[model samples]
Target: MWLTGRSIALIAAAAVSLALAALVGIPALLYVTGLCAGLVAVAVVLAVLARPRLVLTRTVTPAIVEPDEPVEVVLDVGVVSGVPVVAGHWRDRLPSTVLGTATGTVPVTGEPRARVEYVVTGRRRGSHELGPFSVSVGDAFGLVQRSLVAGGRDRFIVLPRRHSLDVRVGPAGATDGATRLHPTSGLGQDDVIARPYLPGDALKRWHWKATAHHGEPMVRQEESELRPTVLVVLDADPRVHDHAGFEWSVSAAASVVAHYGGRGFDVDLATGAQQVSLESGHGLQDALVVLALAEPDSSPLIIPARERTTFVMTGSLDSTSAARLLQAVPSRDTIAFVARGTSEDAHGALAAAGWHVVVRDSNEDLEAAWAAATGVPA
Candidate 1:
């Protein structure tokens, strides 16, 4: 409960009226003072009654989206008891870091229900709460105001957007021991199970016997082929990078994983301590989300496995660490994305050590960096 500017002015007028009536002995001034006081009392009571009657409900379309995409938020406000509500103001509470403060006016105009809609962009990748809508109502006379917090919150996730890669890739590295144990069976082998041919099935792998028996082309469901693994190591040391640099490194790592995974190359994602190999029963989206929310890795980078191709994204790396990284993968198979601040000698040593090196300055685009490092157009 609070007094509006109009309420303050009215009270001041009443005080003046009383003063004039007492000093000049004017009886009409007393009547004027009484009227003003009565109106003020009525305004205050109306404001109190109007506040509790407001209802707010928040809804969002496409609650899950990629970062930097726009999202629509709708706020439905209605009055209980179908009563006429005066024009009011409203503001939706959101995290400043996520979305800036959003505020506007609520015009009832004799309607029992009203809707307020706004747009906000998901600027980062993560799960975030949208709002607890707040509304402020004042009396028609604007003599008193009441503020109420009314709506529940909504949760949404801004997933990391995957980048497209147009470059050609080489054969995958060796399969893990687990894959070796479950090698794909051949068509004529006893373990062979024939299934109806699906699109993209190789014609050469079709079983002629099964096709003749079933009158439809059937393909052997050979166990999935084991592809060479591409290990991706992301260095998230906070001491080495600012927030922007860390995000870039994350996006770079995610892009590499996605590029390799899409190309049928077994992809493995690793941070300072966490390692997720998609070939080993890990979900792709889950891996991307982990990368999206990855914090600076306090522990140093330790390669989890040997692979045909290794992509390393880091803020900074010393010569010793660079040398160790080169030895982690096959010769000329490591590609390094080094954020600015790494020494020239480190870059030179990594390159001389047969690692493809890309040195990126602040805010460098990932596609451009990749093109520069691999000598391929994005």
Candidate 2:
């Protein structure tokens, strides 16, 4: 129930008389009540007739951004004929990942059109929805309020940043006849020869004829090849800490893949999300598009094992998982490019599994780690 000015005035007058009965005396209080009630009634009637109907709309620019990038949002409001709307409150709905303050009430000016603008910075990568902004308008007297919800929701896609690395990992295992090559082309093969049975030599590659002649087991020591297949595996676990670091790792991995892909090597990408295999002619643009569209995943790796597989992970790995990954392709060379600050247990497990582990602190270290893993000159 809403009160008119006359009703409010009459109530005020009665309250004043009760107060006067304890102060100026009941007679004076009663005399003043009648006069005040008549005036207040007029004010209430005027207030009720002046409230206005309002409509609000909102728009956001470039509804997508990279992590840490900013976006602009604008709100427009219109008033329909009714009681004049003096002031109102508006609340903007934003994604939880977005950081900062967002809610305001602005006084309406002589003109009904009002524009409210603000900037939002995204702290993580993923798709976010914003909207269904709300508004509540009221008359100057604060007698009546009409609230409304307006505007459709908008979506924003936050992409990971581009990262670069220094390491290049080579394909796993050695092939007969041809030298053991680095996964990427252009780098020349090593020219080392095998000597009489070394403690570390694998028995499978042993030359029995040489062992018979020399009276000792001897394994062929051929130079590493120059045309190695490079596979980059990305861990998309959202539970991992340091979102920025993970994104950077992805960028660095992409850079390496692009570099090797351009050099005519067969490059394959494995992520928690999906697998992408590109033959020699695919360019960086295709790779970038994939990176931009990639989102964090908690799924297990489903890609089949190959001769050379490089696992690029941004978080720590457990022993069982590491063992399973290694078992998937026993003959293939495995390189685990992990974040620099992983736990000792993870490191120990990977090392025990015979994976060439390269610890990187930033995306910048990726290329260097790869080069080191594959024994390629930087």
Candidate 3:
């Protein structure tokens, strides 16, 4: 509830009339005071009773998105139980992570309904809430004002900015053609001919020999090789990365996942404290979110084993961590994308440790940078 300027002026006028009646001993002035007071009381009641009841429905297009991506929000306003207000304003509450214009004049139409639209850009990562819409309306005489609030909070998941990358993941020539991949095709001797039966198994393709041995029906299915695994490590030590640098590292890590997990290869995302397997498929979405929310930690970097392919995103490598990495990985086996600001001594340390060290790609010109490094077999 709020008192408008008009309401304040009316109260002052009523007080003046009452004072004049007492000063001049005029009973007629009492009628003026009573009428002024009555008008103010009536306006207050009208403002409350006549204010429109706004029911809000909020819709956000592409509820989940990468950082800096535009997301459209449409707000539908429905009037249910009060006098329809022609003069009113609506404003939406938004968090700092999202940027948009959230206030506008309420529309007037033949029906008691309206729509409001605003495009917001996600400035940061994580799940952000956008709402608790409010509308303000005043009485016909404009003596007083009131507001009505309605609507539920909508959550928008913002992922780290994903960049274009053309480089292939996993070690080159690590597996023979037969072991690396075997596509399922029309029935033939080369194709896999025996597997446990599934609900949709075709009767003609059943393998009788395996079924007789196992005492159950077996079905012929395509033989696909296990995907090669890659480990993408993030050097997010608090001593190295500040806010901007940390974001760049996170985006780089996400691009690595997109390279491996996006293409049906197995990937593991690792920080100092945790590691998550990001298997290709719906797992890609979960992997991106993990990178988006990644922060600088105090834990020491974990050196992955020599068997799996390893890619590291880091600002600089000190001698101590470089020595530890050399002990775990074979010569020239690990690849390190060091930031532009990395010192010469750090580069020497990594090279001495047998890492295929490359210049960390800049956020700008992402594809070109990635291709330049991973274009050659590692």
| lDDT scores in order | 0.68, 0.60, 0.68
Model 3 accuracy (lDDT, Cα): 0.68
Instruction: Tell me model 1's lDDT, rounded to 2 decimals.
Output: 0.68
Candidate 2 vs. true structure, TM-score = 0.56
- CA shift at 320, candidate 3, in angstroms? 3.8
Off by over 4 Å in 2: 1-14, 17-56, 79-87, 105-113, 140-143, 166-231, 237-268, 276-298, 304-311, 327-334, 339-355, 360-378
Worst 10 residues of 2 by lDDT: 177-186
Give the TM-score ranking, best first: 1, 3, 2
Per model, state how many residue pairs clash: 4, 30, 0
Model 1 lDDT per residue over 221-244, tens place = 544532245678887767667787
Of 1 and 2, the candidate ahead on TM-score is: 1
List TM-scores for all candidates, in order.
0.70, 0.56, 0.68
Give the candidate number with the greatest TM-score.
1
lDDT score for residue 340 of model 2 = 60
Model 2 over residues 70-126: C-alpha lDDT tens digits? 787887877664546555677778878887555888655677788877778776666
lDDT of 3 by residue, 71-154 (tens): 999988876646534447888999987888899987776676788889998878878788899987776677767777886889
